[model samples]
Target: MATTDSDTTTTDDTVLSMENVTAGYGNTTVLHDVNVAIEDGQIACLIGPNGSGKSTLMKSIYGFADVKAGSVHFRGQEITGRSPQANLKNGISYVLQDASVFPNTSVHENTLMGGYVFEDDEKAAQRAEVLYDEFPILGDIRQQDAGTLSGGQRRLLELARALMVDPDVMLLDEPSIGLEPRFIDDVFERIEQLNDLGTTILLVEQNAEKGLSVADRGFVLASGEIKFTGTGTELLNDEQVGRLYLGG
Candidate 1:
């Protein structure tokens, strides 16, 4: 969907919008009127201190949290509190902070799970082939059980599986978690490569410097409310973000 100056969907500008959203877990409120705008093919990040509700917001968007108020609009349509399956059908995919793959399953089977939503088996196979080429490690490990792979390898497999859907918007929770320093850098590089290929990304990062570094726009959530929103460079330069989150 090509976007215009006025259109809020697809034209490479603000494809996702959350307006006055109030959502939470059972009896535990997490987000309070949280609002944000993510543009098309943009790498948008959320960074904050612990207990800031960054994960809560990500879960809400992915339909894991209960939305009590407000609306979530994607591609200019209301999707507030939609089911997880519904969100996936609408071109949204989520990769959680931890290893979300079936560790006991072979890498190929794990990846095949990603294409289960497709109706045509042949098309699914073709999609898997394309992703296998894009992520050759997955191809090599197609017969290997995911449980035996290292953390970084598993992380890569998880990402490749997410791309199996060819999602328009990808939500990532702490893609750098628990990775060795070398692999951590590689992970961020892979994320940048994805963004360069026109995949929209919404990321939650514990490493504020790295998060704000690669992102086009960054948001700060403190106490379940957005404290700041700006370009990655601007966020890195901001005194408040630097002092509080980035520890600069």
Candidate 2:
């Protein structure tokens, strides 16, 4: 299948979108004329080689990167250049690629941190409890120090914490990165479960095949530009995409 520009077209169902966005850090642009839209209740995957601005794109959406041009919209409202704090308050949660837990904090406490935007402490605690019900393993170790968790446990903790806000959109940067094969599958399963529960997700994944396997839509980006866009299966089966990005 050949790449098309239709992925940039936003529709009534579009929950998150970037139009002609040029973003990067401190005047050093990493993305160029990027256009992508994620529909409501869909799992969209962005796959590219290292240094291809995948993480930058995630940051751009979450207000971590500077959008030098164009606009970003969420639920039809413009949010270009919004602060990270504001973005979180507006129901956008980001799970970073790097370690993000407090080493000395208890597991339950870390989970509560996700609801920092909540005006009441009790509500945050209640939200954490609800998340624990969805992630029983975290509930079982609520008292353990975050530093003591395994890699997979830490990843799950990150996911649960991010959900503290009950976000409408989740920007997951390399969710399965650095995990063992066993843990990787578990993380992906959790991602699917989240999508099933009504959270629209935009994921930047290193494992091209596995990422697209679960994605409802897929985008291929390179050198700070979008190169392809289609249904997950369409991109996965594309001869060029397979030979280049998928290592076929």
The most accurate candidate by lDDT is 2
Candidate 2 C-alpha error for residue 80, in Å: 0.3
What local distance difference test score does each model get? 0.85, 0.94
Q: Candidate 2, residues 1-248: lDDT per residue as tens digits?
A: 54665546999999999999999999699999999999999999999999999999999998899999999999999999999999999999999999899989999989989998899999998898899999999999999999999999999999999999999999999999999999999999999999999999999999999999999999999999999999899999999999989998
Off by over 4 Å in 2: none
Q: How well is each residue in 1-248 modelled by candidate 1, as lDDT tens digits? A: 11111322233456898888888999999988877889887999898888989998998988999988888889888898788888887889999987798988999888878877888888888988898898888798799999999888888988988887899999999999998988888888899999999899999999888998898888888888887888888889987678877887
Q: Which regions of candidate 1 fall more than 4 Å away from where they truly are? A: 1-12
Q: What does the lDDT come to for candidate 2?
A: 0.94
RMSD of each: 4.2, 0.9
